[model samples]
Target: MRRKKGLSIFQKLFIAFLGVGLITLTISGVVRYRAKKGFIERTIKSQLTDSRERSINYFNRTFTIPIKKDLGFIEQSSSLNNFLTSQRDEALLTKPPAERLFLHFTKMPESIYLSSRFIDSKGREKIITVGKKRVRDYATIDHFPNNVLYRRIYSLFERLKEENVGSILFEGPFRYKNNKHTFVIGISKMEPEIGGFGGAIIFLCDLTGYLNYLSDIKFNQIPIAFVFRPDNHVMLSPEKEASPGPDLYQSQEENINDALFVSSSIKLGSNNNVLLNLALIIPRKIFSSELKNALIDSVLIGVCLIIFVGFVAFFISMRLFAKPIEELSRGTGRIGRGDLDYRIKIETHDEIAQLADEFNRMTESLQKTTVSRDMLIQEVNERKRTEEALKESEEKYRTQFEEALDAIFIADAEKGIIVDCNHAASELVGRAKSELVGKHQQILHPPEEIEGEFSRTYKQHLKEKEGQALEAHIITKNGEIRDVSIKANIFEFKGKKFLQGVFRDFTEQKRSEEEKKKLEAQLQRAQKMEVVGTLAGGVAHDLNNILAGLVSYP
Candidate 1:
């Protein structure tokens, strides 16, 4: 297998930062998505619940009126009932009995109340009204008796008795001709004027129009309103599929296929015992729209966040990792090309910075220790020129030093040992330069002056820096004592302290001064003798002249 390529520092940094950004964004997105989804669900449930409550309240308002309430209008009219039973042919509702039934039935609404007919104990019509204009007594109903329409009514009544009945019975939904539906509402009554005959007032209702009206009720036209049986048959609906489905009738509230079905009982008649359910069908998209919108927004926001963090990571990788490493690489290249002075300028406070510092130090060592042949030669020549200059300067000063009349000695200030002496100092000490050097400064002086005059002068030179000479005596190499005046001072050279003293020899001069004093004393004595002899000669000459005269007289 070939060698696998490894990721570079920049690649590693890019991957690390980008991966971290993605992970963090993923976590945040998940949390935000969950929160948004939950909020949307809650809002949908709240809206659906509110809509269900409002629908119940609305249906309650519309169906509150009972259809069975005739206010005892037909039941209390005994004369009208007896006349309706006695009449065979009712003429245009002109008979008092027919006119009373017509006017009474007219009070019922035409939409739900199609017609009202009163039956005697034999179940025959005494008075009947269809709509506002048509009226028929018991004779007229026998001719038109129970058409496909009335047969459907009687058939519906059969279905009504099976239900839980109250003071009034509400039933229906018998399929009429032209695909219409019919319902019947009735109550048993006793007419005392007609031999206490047991009878009933049955109303034929146009249920299709009323059911359509109820179905048409909607909230902003979104949900469909309808009535359904326990068997899932749609009694009335805006869509009118006839059979909605088997699942809808499971409960008062249900969710099927992502849609919500909320139902409330539509109670009718005086007893309000008719159990019809008004179902409000809410589709899937209406309530799910909140969750859908939240999903879209969360995806968009998550994408944006990931992109922004990735961009930031790109720059961070470059600044923190790539740039420094590139500089170090360039520095290495420079060093390879013999530019040892080149250094990486890395500003990062990390291991990369430490590497740069170590690189610079290695480069510095190379600069000091490693060089090309021509560079070595140039350095050597430069050093030779410096050495020649120093030697020439030392020779110029040494000539003046050696030709000096006074003897000079240099000693270590800390060691009190003589380090160097000029030629004159060697001669004054009566010893060679090698013998005098490396010895103590006190060794040049007499034994008595080692701790006395010489010691004071040496310590005073260190204390006062520079001062006048002190008279001192030294023993020469030949065993002669020499008198000298020593002047010493402290000075620093090459990071060390040194003491230098100049010795002036005055023994021969002192002897010449003593010989001149002895010569002057002898000359003074001879001159005094000459002066006395001259004065005696002058007195003798006078006395001889006088003695010659006195001897002649004596």
Candidate 2:
């Protein structure tokens, strides 16, 4: 018979180090890639959501609230009410409402409203505009011969008289001159003190102009802003279309050039009325570019680290393990080649050094056992000496097994019965040797639990020479449950298949790991909230300035 050749210690150590380095590199790469992907996804979604929220806030602050305040001012205007109460007069429309009241339409830039007009309860009309634009004759107009505008105006007037409405922001009519849309922000009580059917004031502003002003204000990265009616008609879109879809009332999501699209719906009235579908198109690529670059850099760094660690590991393994193991190998080779006097010399204190000492002792013992064969040629004496040596080896094996620090248990593989256990096992389970020796292995585990795990682990140990370790809950004699990690293997003992296992307590380590994960999650949420707070502060500052201007401009 010939012995098979095996890998040298140097080769084995190099392979082990290389495998570890490659596996580490692979796992790190995967984790980094996934984390980067998740971060980018989160950042993109967050930016889109933030952009939508800011858009709504800005729209309400810049356009909606100011419009409401302007209408409120018109409702409280005593001079305008006096002007309308007396009769429709061109001279009264030309002047300011009062010394304290400034006409909003006259103060606004000519580009803002295009034209601001007033219509009374008697169906009389007068223009109170800033510029000398030709006033279209509303009486001679044939666009609404069926009186659709008149009916809508009357309905709003009724709502105002009944106090059902204070002010209204509504889409009124289309101007025939340029066929442009108009938004009428009207107030019912032009003269509230008079207390008798006081007429309303309608401000005709070009919808396109207001939406253009809104879209011009870029919140971040030049967002595209547009509005769509419930009928899917484009009311105002200074930029390109935000999304290509049939439904225009609801919010939308789209992707363009790796950019995310988000939309919000801001209705102008209370009763499912005019829906201004505001869509803001922002580039997510711009937001995630830094994270993408960071991920690439991380991958490169991981590769470099893997290479550097492999080289360092190889150098250390050569010095700590390979050299001593190589010397032991050479001594064994010499002994096999008839040089039994050769002894391995190692100066380290690790496992490899211990192996060298054990090998040397083995050679010395072999020499002592066979050296006297030439001096005394008695078969019975040699047989007796061999038996004595075998008994001594068995005693040493028993002592090592019984005195091991970790709890060890031997059970019958087929029946799951505890056949043998050491002192450590008895102390760990809090049971006497006599009480546990003949009992089933289930006595050491939680009742109604861990049964499936016990069966699976036992079957796995029976099939594998090198088994795996797993966490399990064990029950002690006092019914206290303990978390433990068990490593089990199968072996044949006295013609019976026995499962032997070592138990290690691992409750504290698992708890620490869970706590660490929870802390990381909390840190992420805190960072997100901090960003939201900063955005809110900036928006609030702008809102304060806007309100100051509205109040101080008059």
Candidate 3:
């Protein structure tokens, strides 16, 4: 089977350390991003709220509140009232009403007015009007020349009359007599007690220059500033292109997508029909853009940290573990290939050092044991060689004895017992070699002739000076008799006298001699018959001549 491929320990460890570092950095980045996002959101919201509130307060302070205060001062001023009331019976000033009012006030309005119907108790109608330097003709002929301003004041006047309000304050886009558009807050006060029956005073303060000044000053990046009437009519704004105003009665304040919007109605007016709305349209992208930059910066820092951590981890691991482990691996490979002398050289005083010490000791022990075992094996091999030489000699003798043609037996001469026999001897006796041993020598002869033939042969062998040869009839293990030629010798082995006999089987030779005698007898009988036939033939010829003579006499 093929082994599966996989990452090595070094790669796995490196990956584990890198993954941990990267994950930690990524988590930190995420947390930081969330925190920054939240902070930016709150900051943006707070800024928008504060900007909206400040703008509203500034608009009221600069336009609405001052106009109303001026109108109230005019209403409570005893000098202005007495001067205006005396206009019913006498001329309070030789100059026109416009110059006269400007003289009586400490801080004069841009335009001041007495109503057209302000006919004092006398038959003269007193139109006391004063106009700013820019709008000198604002009170000309006791009428507003700008139709837009005329309509706005007329509307507020009608509403104040309907509500029975003494004074009405309103804010709108008013065109000056100079034909220039300006935002203004106006307060029309109807004091029935002062001036006469048709007595009224109108104070108009031009806020267009102030609003334009504010429009040039921006918060961060020029936030959108606009002024709308209560009916959402665009009175003042910085947009070059005019805005498509909302419904005339639209009163809801809402944010548009990513822009934050807030509107504040001027509260200084008793005129419900008119409202001064100051709106700040702050784009939300400012906050998001800042947040995005912060997030990018945080991520960059996190990446740098992760990279630094990875490098540190790599350096530490290489120094502390990798080099030592690599040395151990190489040592293991060398040892596995039978290099018992190889040793791991770890320099650190840690567990690896201990392991190297143990390994070196084991290698030393193995080397020593290997040398000792080699010496012992050499000694054992010498002993084995000697044993093998003896075995070879024994095997040669056994092969000759088993291969002999004649049956050979060794019998103890003193005991008259068979001691050992070859395979041929066992065959001649019709018994196995194992069965022939330890048996009396009489077993080789017939049962009737055993004591006589075997005893004589043994006695002859014992008495003769040399070994003896004899013909003998032996009985096999099955009781069949066979004639064998036997030669016997007396030998002394290990200080004991033993009889050795070599026997040749003669059963086939005796059969052949009997067959030859019968064939010779048959040949003699055939020769005698041949001789008698020759004599009979000659005598018969003579007898035939005599018998011929006797037959002629008949």
Candidate 2 residue-pair clash tally = 0
Worst 10 residues of 2 by lDDT: 139-148
Question: Candidates' TM-scores?
Answer: 0.41, 0.42, 0.42
Which structure among the candidates has the greatest lDDT? 1
lDDT for every model?
0.68, 0.66, 0.65
Tens-digit lDDT track of model 1 for 231-302: 456776666553456556446765566565666665666556644566666666764676667777877877
Off by over 4 Å in 1: 1-64, 71-73, 76-98, 101-111, 137-148, 152-166, 193-197, 214-223, 229-231, 237-243, 269-275, 286-290, 298-554
Candidate 1 vs. true structure, TM-score? 0.41
Cα displacement (Å) at residue 195, model 1: 9.7
lDDT of 3 by residue, 243-311 (tens): 535642243356566665555565556644444566666667756777788789878887887788777
Model 1 residue 149 lDDT?
A: 59
Error of 3 at 501 (Å): 99
* Model 3 error, position 155 (Å): 4.0
- Give per-residue lDDT, candidate 3, residue 42: 64
How far residue 27's Cα lies from its native spot in candidate 1, in Å, is: 5.7
Clashes of each: 0, 0, 1
Candidate 2 residue-wise lDDT, 1-554, digit = tens: 99898986666877987887788776886788788877776665676677668767765665576666676776666666565555446545534443224344545464334445555555455434534343446531223245444555455555655544355645554443367665555666544455654555555555655566556745454646666665667765545444545453364664555455677777564343554676655555555677668888988887888788778877877677767767878887887787778888888888877887887788787888876675466776788899999999999978998899888999988888898888888888899989998887878887655444354455566677347897678888998788888899888978988889998877678888899999999999999999999999999999999999999995
| Angstrom error at residue 195, model 3 | 10
